[model samples]
Target: MTKSRIRAAKPDTQPHFDYFYDKPGSLPGTLNIGVDAQPPVIVLIDYNEADATRQTLATPEECLPYLDTESVSWVDVQGLGSEDILQRLGQVFNLHPLVLEDIVNVPQRPKVEDDYEDHLVMIARMVIPKESGGFHSEQVSFILGKHYLLTVQEEPEHDCFEQVRQRIRYNKGSVRKLGADYLAYTLIDSIIDGFFPVLEAYGEQMEDLEDEVITKPTRQTLNKIYRVRRELLNLRRAIWPQRDAIAMLIRDDNDSLISDRVQVYLRDCYDHAVQILDMVETYRELTSGLMDVYLSAVSNKMNEIMKLLTVVSSIFIPLTFIAGVYGMNFNTEKSPWNMPELNWYWGYPLCLAAMAATAAGLIYFFWRRGWFENFSDVQDRTSRKRG
Candidate 1:
């Protein structure tokens, strides 16, 4: 099946949770889909030890024949755009009204539900790395039954399950021989593993941001830092509950839907969830540190500029005083004390020499105090500004 059946989310890496809120007084089990949503694509894969088959079905009713079979059946629905199609799938799977509501709802948080006797439902957030420096995320709902697993996704594109699909098609592992519980575990593990590559990209972006925060922080740098923090918060919100959901799966051994063997595998999947949460937390802290560093850098740069300007102003103070005293216009003819040097031919030259000497002395004093050396940052900024 082509992975391009779903549309790409917006190019930005923002929270991908599809929030579903009904009218305040709306009845329960109401299905609300985005008007722009595309009709869902249904694909069925039925397999036993000896045979395996894969086909795209036109409608959800076509999945009924395989759902009751002894062999493992995987019904994959790729979109939640069509309310009629979703309602049909719910009926075909004998889904509870609330379960149908949760499934159709874009995002109902990351949790695992086993209230229904026939199936175990797992709601998770899956992320796909985008080529343009961010990630695309969506909701993946898993309904695992005795002999079949029904998987529904928010969108059909940017799929992270191609490897699992390949493994199932080629029988690379025991996924074919195992029950739907194992298939659920495999796909769950794949979904959790999908977070690693996305986290790696975040790690790289944060490293670049660390340098940018210190070297030369700009408004754009601040914006990027804010985005990284917001996105990481979204990631934390996603993976935090997911860890509890996975834990619930492992702890709820009474639910006969999931085999003990698969639960063991789920333990490892839970570990991955915990690991992803740690990464999100670590990145969040790093982004916060980047903000602090940006502020300090800007403040420090401003201080350097103020220091340079102070030194320049200090050097001119004495020269201004000398000129001010000479311009007082005292009449030398009235008294000797008025201005003894005013009639001298060398007075103008002496005054100019005095001003030049005063400036040089102030400059030397500031340089001796190491104030001039501190202006290196200011000098660099000035040079760049000129350039």
Candidate 2:
């Protein structure tokens, strides 16, 4: 099995900037985007209660006319490789300088800010599906205006907004009746709920590790437990700040951009965030206990090894001394005192009998004192029973 490697990460090694930085206090609406980003793909979804029109546009300027229209316009930009296109996108959307900078930055902390413009900027994170049971997450920024919502994703392929698109296209939900704020809420809620299945998978893994660590801990087992712990820490870091961001959205009395109804829904999203936090915390605690149990298990195995060595030495040390004494020749023919036993007819049998008695007595002593029973129990539990 391929397990994630256990490596230590220093605070210094943590990311200073999630993405390449633009100069501080750069002109408002200036685009200092990444060089390696893919060319932006714009998906325009214009919708109202009676009708909806979805189109793919060639340039950011093409979506400009609908921004001031009566219907709700959602301009979704995925991928950010071309600086020229991104800079134009900032102009077309009339985004604040800081808002544009936040969108281009790949991994900004999830946040919501209102800078006294016609927009409410929300920095939400999205986690993509992992093929190998691991996760990769990216940042998605939402700029909500009076009649339009502009969304920009870090990468082209990582998207979780398909459900919201379907809701609008198929008119499956109340999305058509709501404004851009509701659309923002729907997308944000989807992003928050995305963490659940990932967290559930982690919970199951930790439960499995709990069994694996205690029953048959090895060096490899230690690595796996630590890997799980490290990943949980990452998950905690992701979910915790997100919870605070959502809380801020609910608690901010100044940002009246989100209506009371949407704020109520944001409360539900907060609950989900709380649930995720609880699971991450619980898993962390379990992982810590597994570490302790692994240490004790390793120590116990070492002790058993020492005990076996002691038992072997105790049984053989005296026997070896007796054999050594007999093997010595002290001039037996000239000294009767030393040669009396050696000359006896049954001397060999008597000496063998004495060794046998000595071995039996030691064995009985160990058995009676429960040392053997303890060893047997350890073997039975570790070998015969399923951990």
Candidate 3:
């Protein structure tokens, strides 16, 4: 099997799980935007059955005229750069204070809320794969009303809504003819489908790790396995709740916020979410198994090393004993028994031959027991396989 090597990432460099929150005992609808947050960019796309118009509005007030129209209006606000702009957006759309807060303070759990009679708030997470490896997650909040859909994304850089926008702009699908609710469903579907490519990358990474763990596990392999596991865990946390949110969108339609047609589409999106979750869970299990395999491989390698050492020691035992006995001072001048061998002309040569014979016999014995065969043949076989 081909060996797979992954560069291990430091623990400190791992993605953080910290979420934003309001201060304890603070006001109910306080907006706490990140200091590093980019400034908000507001783009409006208004369309009806007859025609569609796309415009880059300078202010949130320009969206008011389109929102109250009969056509479906999509107000895409990318970034939470300024609190004043977001607050004005909330006023322009008549958004609930709590709704605006949720949109601003991101990293919220994926959920759907119907606190207002005229609007439904849905929070979803979108994961974008990094060029090097791994993924970055951001929150995308949706506010669906009678004739308008407002989407607030944490950052303006990466999103899965481009295809949805193309469909709206080109009138590729039934999106142009649908209401705001259908538009909301389309964006949500895009978000769900975005997970596939990221999950596929992880799947391939896991396969590589599986081979590396079993064949030639190293400290770096252990670290890579742990990193993959941690990433999978983060993926699970992001998708599990999103799945429930989609299911809730399909199951609970008390306010009739989602049309029957859109509900059917949401069901498909929900299935995709479930599939992504299943893949993540399976990869997680495989990574966990890889960790166990790594441990066994290390242990087996150590065992082989020790076995070779023992064989060498066994062969030298008798040779060392013979040399020691010959070197001992036995008073050969006074004792006849000890003096007989000491006086022999061939005694030194015979002792050397005996020691050599003892070592050769033990080596043959070990070879016959297949001890030497294992280490000698193992490397050859591995090389042949690689070739």
Model 3, runs deviating above 4 Å: 1-16, 330-387
Decoy 3 TM-score against native: 0.82
Residue pairs with backbone atoms closer than 3 Å in model 2 (clashes): 29-97, 37-81
Least well predicted 10-residue stretch by lDDT in candidate 3: 1-10
Tens-digit lDDT string for candidate 3 (1-387): 111122235644434364556655678777876778999999999999888889888999988788778999999999998989999999998888988887888778899987688888899999888888888788999999999999999977988899888888788989988899999989998888888888889988988988888878899999999888988888898899999989888876534778888888988899889999999999999988898899999999999999899889977977779778777767777878765877789988997887789778988997898866767688999999999
- Candidate number of the best lDDT: 3
Error of 2 at 18 (Å): 5.8
TM-score-wise, the better of 2 and 3 is 3
Better by lDDT, candidate 3 or 1: 3
Model 2 alpha-carbon drift over 4 Å, by segment: 1-36, 252-255, 327-387
Q: What 10-residue stretch in candidate 2 is worst by lDDT?
A: 1-10
Please report the candidate that would top TM-score against the real structure.
Answer: 1
Residue 132 lDDT in model 2?
72
Q: Write the per-residue lDDT of candidate 2 for residues 1-387, one digit (tens) a residue.
A: 111122235542223234334455555545545556788899999999899999999999998799888899999988877877888888887776667767876666778787656777788778765767757777888888888998888886877788888899899888999888889889988988888877878877887877887788889888878777777777777778889888877875635578888888889999999998998899889889999999999999999999899989987998788889688766767877776877779988998898889789988997998866766788889886775
Give per-residue lDDT, candidate 2, residue 236: 78
Give each model's clash number. Answer: 0, 2, 1
